[model samples]
Target: MRRSREGYEIYPVADAIGGISPTAHDNAMQRMIQAGAQPVNAISLVAELQRDWGRARADELRSILRWYFPKLQEIRAQN
Candidate 1:
């Protein structure tokens, strides 16, 4: 929320963050949204950051995804 106040675009990974209780988590998520933070999951965050597959850093991004998200790589391979 401080970042959002500072005019930074905050993208909180919805699935990766949580509070002690379900109610707390929901409230925190709501607060973030109210503060102008965009909630995204891991996959959506990656896709947003790597919008251009044919960019110069495509290979580097692929390497990162392969290392951190092996399941995604596997799915891509299967397709």
Candidate 2:
């Protein structure tokens, strides 16, 4: 059981896990690798990469955004 800042009772974010599964490593890596594949997803991915992973990763994220931004602009120009 937990209480919030105002002292109201609150449910936990999730129940405690007995133990982490070994495959969790591979699953997390796969999610990271595939996150840049979509437009909306790329936005968050760039933010996360910049804030947490620093300049090198941020530059890579910028390149990904630049690659996709032109396509989006073309789509906007069509309408």
TM-score of each: 0.57, 0.34
| Model 2 lDDT, residue 27, Cα | 60
Model 1 weakest 10-residue run by lDDT: 1-10
Task: Return the TM-score for candidate 2, rounded to 2 decimals.
Answer: 0.34
All models: lDDT? 0.84, 0.51
Total residue pair clashes for candidate 2: 0
TM-score for candidate 1: 0.57
lDDT (Cα, tens digit) per residue for candidate 2, span 5-27: 57655321111212266477446
> Residue 8 CA error for candidate 2 (Å)?
19
lDDT for each residue of candidate 1 in 1-79, tens digit (9 for 90 to 100): 4465567888889878889998999999998898878889987888888899999989997887678777766868999
Best model number under lDDT: 1
